[model samples]
Structure formats: structure tokens, C-alpha cells
Target: MRIALAQINPVVGDLLGNADRIHAALAATEVNGKVSADLLVTPELSLWGYPPRDLLFSAAHLEQQQQALDQLQQRLHAEQLDVALLVGVAEVAPDQQHPRLFNALALVQARGWQVVARKQLLPSYDVFDETRYFRASSSPSTLSLRVNNRDWQLGLSICEDLWVDEELHGQRLVGPDPIASLIPERLDALINCSASPFSRRKGTLRHELAARAAERLQCPVVYVNQVGGNDELIFDGASFVIAPGDDTPLLQLPEFAVSTEVWTAASSTDRLEQPSRAHQQANTPDDDLEALFRGLVTGVKDYATKCGFKAALLGLSGGIDSALVAVIAAAALGPDHVQSLLMPSPWSSSGSIADALALATRLGIASQIVPIQTLMEGFEATLTPALNAEPSGITAENLQSRIRGTLLMAMANQQGQLLLSTGNKSELAVGYCTLYGDMNGGLAVIGDLYKSTVFALCHWLDSPDAGACRAELGLGGSGPLIGQAILEKPPSAELRPDQKDSDSLPDYERLDPLLMDLIEQRMSGEQLIGAGHDPDDVKRIERLFRRAEFKRRQAPPLLKVSKQAFGSGWRLPIAAI
Candidate 1:
């Protein structure tokens, strides 16, 4: 049996468009003048896209979903294509109770499409809210197809169904063991369609989980993942096929890119006994820095294009955060369409201005020098008399940031471009960012990246290994897109004279590990202190992180790259102490 893995990026809530993309991928079945595969497999929720969220509640969304299936069926019949398709969809059952939908996989053969497998595991924790919308299935599903005058029993599972092994995850997700239940079925192959989001080292975990499943079932397991950025979540689709007793994958697909490739099952020994021929076609794994870089670029590209924006603009203050964001935007939206405004305040250094221009030139992006000195003087004059004194301290510092934010917003609105926020996770976690000031934008490109990670990514982009990525993204002929001067300098906001970030917060070197302990590890302040973190810094950071809830609530949607980003998964009450 030959199967095609259609690794695609689908826009959320675009059912008609998503269906059309699937139809197109299926139509391109010829490779070197030969039909590629007899069957096609799409990612989880490939029809309506992943995490439609509350849009699932809309009647029109449900209506369009059925319409999309009808259109896909017509296209398959009209073209007289003989390929069988396994597509993920939201299956609605009218006889069910409150939540009537099931995260389902439909088998589309010559007859038509029908629900073949309903997802039994609906994960509710950490960025998943499927329990609020989907009801779980009671039994695992198996599909039998006749190929080469022999019946092939195949077990079908959704994303979380294969993830139920407590040994790999430390604990179960309060659901029945879906993978183990399939053990009695004695299947030839297992297929899992996933829309799993990317986190640090998650690809390794996915590989391990699939390997374990293959070992238990004693069959080849194929994992298909959705690729693209959907709002806060970025899916790094590293689709592959693993067989029992094999150290490497039998077949491997590309990562962080869209693909449609075929793999043929061997007839002699069920394709499990032979060593993988895919080793000759396998690609090397990306290092952590490269993964982070691709995630940022993919996040910006999808957020802007899906939201109907062709151009992007950001406030470039010659700081590392803004500089890194500018580079990412240039790579994402193209340097020609990416615009940067050097909104230098009175306190901004001349060297900073020079560094910003040099970066713009190196990236081949258009830049404008927008001085805010006059705006500062005008605002001070307009408000000082009302208070009977000039605004000073934090208020004065925030005013400078607001002036630049306003200018950037105006440009974004006037030119109809998406504004990318440049604040990093360190600033956002500690409330070092102003509410409407540095936090204003349509999307936070690197909001999940800490200051330390930001520097590391920039350094990697400048290395020789990143040359192919730079060229692929159309970046300038560059040793480094981010200038060296911007790197070696002390990190500063430049809102006030010689104002370093350390003045407001601890050095990121000492701060990021403590933050990881608190945020991802969910450690308490006392626990962090006991683990050798600075007691004073931990106490202050906890207070700051708690107090900034309201600000984060009002800020733009941030792209998620970390295990626990400040997105939909991180919920906290603002009224609490």
C-alpha cells in the first residue's frame, strides 16, 4: 500500500479555503510521470483547521464544514481520482448530549466520506480545551481495506489518543489509555493525525511516544502533524513513519514546511522487518536556536497573512528586542514589505541611531528616522500646567514609550500594515513594558522569547549554518542581519539617560532560569528560593508577574514558542493580591 502524507498549513475558520487547499494537494498526484500514492492522509483538523476555538459554537461554521465536505467529494468524483483519503473533521451527532461534536477522522473512499474514527482522548490541560466542545468516544476504531487480494487492518487514532502512556508523560491526562486499548485489535498499521503545538524539545517527545506505540502494537505507526502558525500556537509539523524494532523512522517528512510525499509498504514482510531505505533521504535535526528562529518567522508570516495584511511595521529603538523582531519580520513578510521606524527620543543615543540604520541597510529593509523630541516637548507643555508641576519619574519615562507607540500605530493604520510588538518575555513577565506603549501591535512576534534567547538566536542567524535559511527567507547577503554593535552594548530602554534594563530588573542571565522555574515548572516563590534562586529577586519577580495580568490581558496576541507562554494557556486573576 502506498500512502501520501499531505502535510499542510491551514488557516483557522477558513473551511472553504481549507477544503480547496486539500483538493489541490490531492490533484498533484503525479511524481516523475507516475501516480504517487493510492491513499492520502491529512493532518488533524485539516478541513476546518485546528483550534477553531469558540468559532465552533457558530452555526455558520458548522454549516460551512458540511459544505466543504460536499465540495471535496464532488471534486474527487469529477476528477475521477481513485485515492482513498483520511481527513480530520469535527463530527456532529444530533442525538448526543450538550457537547455534540467529536474530533473525528473521516474515511473517504469511492463511495463517499463517513466518520471512521472518533477521538477517545480529549486533552483539556495546557492550551487544549476540547472537553468544552467535544465528547469522548468509548471504543477505538479500526479500518480494514483490501489491497493486493489481502485484508489490511489499520488502527486510527487522533492526537491525544497515542499520548496516553504515563511512563513518557510522567502521569496520565485523566483519560483512558487509548493506545493500549488498540493492542487487542492486532492491526497491521496505526495512523495518528495531530495538530500538536511546538514547544522546546517537544519533537523528541513526539518521536518517543510514536516509537513506544509502534513497539506495543508491533506495527508501523505514521504520525501526521499540522504545519503553520494559528494565532498564539505554532505547529511545527515533523511528520514521520516509525516501525517496530527500528531505531530510525521508515519514512520521514520535512519539518516546519508544507509537503506531500508518498511511502509504499513492502509486500514481503509487512514493511516492518526490513531496514529503512529512508536513511538516504533523511534530513538532519535542527538545533534549538534554528528551531526558535523558524518558529518566529512562521509565526509572523501566518499571523500577518491570515489577518489580511501584506506589510508589517515596528518601532525600532536600536535595542536588541526590537532589532530581533525587525529581522524576523523582514524574513517573514519580505524585506521589501517590512518597514521600520527609528523612533528616537531626546535621550536616545546617536550611536543607537547609527546602529539602527546600519541594521536596516544590512537587511535591505526600508527605514525612516522619526524623531520624537518635538512630540515630547509638546506633550510636556500640554500636561505640565494641569498638574502644577512637570510629570517626572515613571510617568515621564512611560510618556516617551507611548509617543513612539503612537507613531508606529499611526503608520500601521495609515499604510494598512500589521504592527509587530517587539517586547520580549522578560519585559512582559516583570511588567517592565508599558501597557499601551511598547505593548501595542496586532501580533507580538517574539513575546515568548526571553532576552537571553533573543541574543542567542541573533548570534546563530549570523553563523554560517544559517546561510541556507537566510537565503530561503530572502534576507540580505548577510554575515548577520542584526548588527554587532546592537549585541555588545548594555541592554537599555533609552527612555531616560543611561537607563539600563538591570536598573529595573536583574540581568537576564540570572533572571531567565528563575523565571523558567516559576512559569514552566510552576514553582512557588519559596520553592524557587529553596532551589538556590535569589530570595529577594524571586519575591520581587513573583509580585511583578502577578501584578502585570491586566496589562497582558489587553496586549496583542503573542506567538507561543515556550512550554508555558503568556497566551491562552496562562490564565490568572487580576483582582487577587
Candidate 2:
């Protein structure tokens, strides 16, 4: 049997539109008036998109989901397509209860569609509230298909259902082992439909898990993942098919793009001993930098388009963080659609101004100078009487930042563009940013990236390895998109004279590791000190992180590229001790 893995991008809450995308993918599988694949599988929750969130509670929205299924089925029948399509949908439960839906897959064929499987694992951890919406199924689901006078048994599972390997994940979800349950049935293949979000090196873990499952089930495993940015989550569609006993994938799709490819079951038997083209590509040393860059680009592109913003705006301070964000915006929205405001203050250096302009020119993005020195003086003069003294030191620095932020917002509002905040994760973690100043924007472009990561990604963009990716992103003539001047220079906000980031926070090289341990690993100050981090530094950084909670709560939504981000996944309270 030939099964087609349709890696698609679905818009959250766009039920009918998502259905059309699925149909378009199905249509692509047709050849000479005949469907090329016996069955096609899409990502989980493809109809209404993943994590529809509160939209799932709307009765009309649920009703529209049924209408969408009917429309898709009608389209298939009208096209006279003989292939069976498996799509994800929210199945209404028979008994009325608190959680009224089952995350399910429906088999749509010539006759119609039916719920073939229900997800058994409802993940309720970070970034997921599935338990609040869905009830777990009791057992595994398998479907029997007869093609060419032969019967094939296929095991069906959803995203979290296949993530039950305690050894691989280091921790297991409290639920039935879907892979183990299928072992007794002796399935032909196991299909996992997922909408898994991308994080650094997450694709590698996914490949390992699938390989493990294929080995245990003793069958080929086809994994289909959702692609595109849905809000803060970026899904890298690194879908693949793995044969039993082989860790290498028989077929692997590209990352961060929509793809559909048919894998013949018979071919896997013949090529078990030989490494496939995908395996060869996979073996070629993985570039985490390239993946990271692509993931961020995908996030920005989809966020802007999905949120109905045609252009992007940002304040370019000739600093690394803003420069990186400018590059991302130019790549995501075309250079013509991306604009920048060079908000130079009295403290802004000439070389920094020159660097920002040169970088903007190289990127082909429009840049306008919006000097804030006069505005800074005006604010100080006006607030002197109210304060009984002129705003000085930190207050003065923040006033400058706020002035630039206000100008960016004004331009964005006038142009109907998205204002991309340029704060890095290190700054956000250490409370180095002002609440409504540098933090004001509709979307935080690199808020999840550490300062060190920002520098590294910039260096990678200038490297030879990024040639293909640069071309793909339409970044032209980039010897060094972000020049050495901006890169080698010390990190600064330019809010005060010769003010360096190190003045307020630890060097990113030292601080980033500490922040990673505290935020991503959930380590306490004592744990950090025990891990050999400086005791005083740990306490100070921890205090700053906790104090910054209120700021993060009010900051714009940041794209999540890490296992833990300051977005929906990080649920720390602002009032916490």
C-alpha cells in the first residue's frame, strides 16, 4: 500500500479554510484521474488547526467543524477520488461531561467518513491544556484495509499517544502505551499524526522516538507533522517514514515547509539494508543554526500573514538584537515590506548609526532616522516640575527608550504594520528592558533567543553554510548581512553614555547558561549554585528573573523556539516570591 504523508499548515479557527488546504493536498496526490496513494494522512487537528484554545468552547465553532468535514467529503466524492483520507477532527463525546470532545481522526472515503481513532493521551503539561478539553480513549485503535485482494492492519495514534517511551523522553506521560498496545495486533504500519511545535534539536528527538516505535512494533512508522506558525508556536514539518530495525528514515520531508510524499510499503522491504536518500541527508551533519534560523523565519512569516499584517516595523539601534530582528523581518516579510526607524539619541555613537544604516542598505529594507535627543530633552524639562527634579539615571534612560518605542508604534500604526520588539531572552530574563519602552510592540521577534544565540545566528547568516538558506529567504548579496562592526561591538542599549549590557547584567556567555538552567530546566538558586554557578551571581540573576515577571506578563507574545519560552508555556505568577 502507498501511504501519502501530507504535511500541511493549518490556521487556527479557520475550519473551512483548513479543510480546503487538506483537499488541495489530496488533489496534489492525483495522477491521470487516479489517486496515487491508497491512503493519505494529515497532521492532528488539521481541520480546526492545533490548539484552537478558547475557540473550541464556541458551540458554533464546533458546529462549523462538522460542516467542514461534510464539505471535504463532498469534494472528494465529486472529484471521484478513490483514495481514503485520514484527517484530524474534534469528535463530540456521547455522554455530556466537562470535557466534551475527543481528539480524533476520521476516515473519509468514497462512502463518507467515520471516526476511526481517538487520542488516548491527553497532555496537560507546559503549553498544553488538553486535559481541560479532551478525555483520553481507553485503548489503541487499528484499521483494516483491503487493497489488491490483501488485508493490511494499521495502528492509529495521535501526537502525545506515540510519546510514551520513558527511556527516550526521560519521563513518560501517565497513560496507555499506544506503541505497546499495537505490538499485540501485529500491525503492518503505525501512523502518528501530530502538530508538534519546533524547538532547538527537537527534530532529532522525534526521529529517535519514531525509530524506537518502529523497532518495537516491528513495522514501518509514518510520522506526519503540522507545519507553519500558529500564534507563538512554530511547527517544523520534518515528517518521515521509518522501517523496523532501522533508525534511519526511509523517507524524510523538508523542515519548515508544507510537503506530501507517498511511501510504498513494498519498497521498504527491498531497501532495508540500503540507506535511503533521506538517511544520507540526515547523516550529513545537522546544522542547528540553520534549523533555528528557518524556524524563526517561519514564525515571523506566518505570524505576520496570519495576523493580517502586510508590513513590519522595528526600531534599529545599531545594536545586535535590533539588527537580528531587522534581518528576520526582511526575510519574513519582503525587504520592501519591512521598514526601520533609526532612533539615535544623544548617547548613540556615529559608528553605531553608520552600522545600522549599512545593515539596512545591505538588507534592502527602507530606513528612516528618528533622532530622539530633542524628545529626551523635552521629556526631562516637562517632567521636572511634576517630579520636583529632572528625570535622571535609570528614569532618563527609560524615557529615551520609551520615546523611540512611541515613534515606532506611531509609524507602525500609521502604516498598518507589525511592530517587532527586538529584546533578547537574556534581557527579558534579567529585567534589563523597560516595560513600555523597549518592550512595546505587537510581536516580540527574538524574545525567546538568548543574547549569545542572537550573535551566533547572525554569524551563521554570514557563513557559507547559510548560502542556500539565504537564497531561499531572498536575502541577496549577503557577504555579511549583519556586519562585523555590529557583531564584534560590545552589547549596549545606547540609552545612556557608553552604557553596556554587562553593566546591568552578567556577560551573556555566563548569564545565558544560568538563565537556561533556571528557565528551561526549572533549577532553583541553590541548584544553580550546586551546579557550580557563582553563588552571588545566581542569587542576583534569580531575583532579577522573578522581578521581571510583571514585565513579561505585559510584553507582546513571543514566538516559542525553545522548550520553555516566556509565552503561554511559562506560567509563572508575577506576584510570586
| Clashes (N, CA, C under 3 Å) per candidate | 0, 0
Quantify how close model 1 is to the true structure by its C-alpha RMSD in Å. Answer: 1.6
The residue-by-residue lDDT of candidate 2 on 1-577, one tens digit each, is 7788999999999999999898888777777956788899999999989879988788998989999989888887887877788999999988889799999999998779999999999988878999888889998999998876678889999999889888889887887888888899978789999999999998888988998998888787889999999889999999999877876688888898887887777532443454344322242227999889888999999999999999999998888899999998988999999999998888899999999999999999999997888888889899999999999888998898888888888989999999999998998988889887899999998999999999999998888888878988899644889989988999988777888888888888889999999998999888999998989899899988899899999999999999899988888888878
How big is the positional error of residue 52 in model 1, measured in Å on the Cα after superposition?
0.7
Residue pairs clashing, model 2 = none
Candidate 1, residue 547: the lDDT equals 89
| lDDT (0 to 1) per candidate | 0.85, 0.88
- Please give, for residues 283-333, the per-residue lDDT of candidate 1 as tens digits: 534687777788888989988888899999988877788889988998898
Candidate 1 yields a Cα-based lDDT of: 0.85
Candidates in order: C-alpha RMSD to true structure: 1.6, 1.9
lDDT of 2: 0.88
Cα lDDT for residue 15, model 2? 94
